[model samples]
Target: MSAPDTNTETQHPAHKTPLAGIAIGVGVAVALLIALMVWLAYNGNEPRDASDGAAAVQIETPTGGSLTITGTASD
Candidate 1:
């Protein structure tokens, strides 16, 4: 006489998909974009060179005064 079956049956594939490549690509792109934005923001926020000081701001005094710009670049 034969014994009853005890093994289980599976309907789907056993191995799961690994989309690490796509994830890595997206991460790299995001990092690059963030770095670029940071670079642009830093450059935009500060003056071009040590010679150029703070940005020119419009000001109207009680009797109107001439603007004198100065730069104190330590390093």
Candidate 2:
């Protein structure tokens, strides 16, 4: 005659996920980046250099003349 089987040691513990914390961290980082970008965009519209002092030159030969423009360098 066999005795009845009993298992008393099996156990599974509850786990806490770190995904919530990670999600919040990432969200805060994205928000800060967006804020920085917005600030830069808002303040970046001011012209750094003054164009009021720009000058053009003109040259003349015996039969022809030429004009040289100063501030029109194209990349």
Whole-model lDDT, model 2? 0.64
Model 2 off-target regions past 4 Å? 1-17, 48-75
lDDT of 2 at 61: 60
- Per residue, candidate 2 scores C-alpha lDDT tens digits across 3-49 of 47544343222122466668889999999999999999989854455
* Predicted model with the maximum TM-score: 2
**Candidate 1 segments exceeding 4 Å error:** 1-18, 45-75
Evaluated with lDDT, which candidate comes out highest? 2
- Report lDDT (Cα) of residue 21, candidate 2: 69
Candidate 2 weakest ten by summed lDDT: 7-16
CA lDDT of each prediction against the hidden true structure:
0.63, 0.64
Residue 23 in model 2: lDDT? 87
TM-scores of the candidates in the order shown? 0.39, 0.41
Residues 1-75 of candidate 1 have per-residue lDDT tens digits of 764763435412332234566788899999999999999987785566445554444556678875654535442
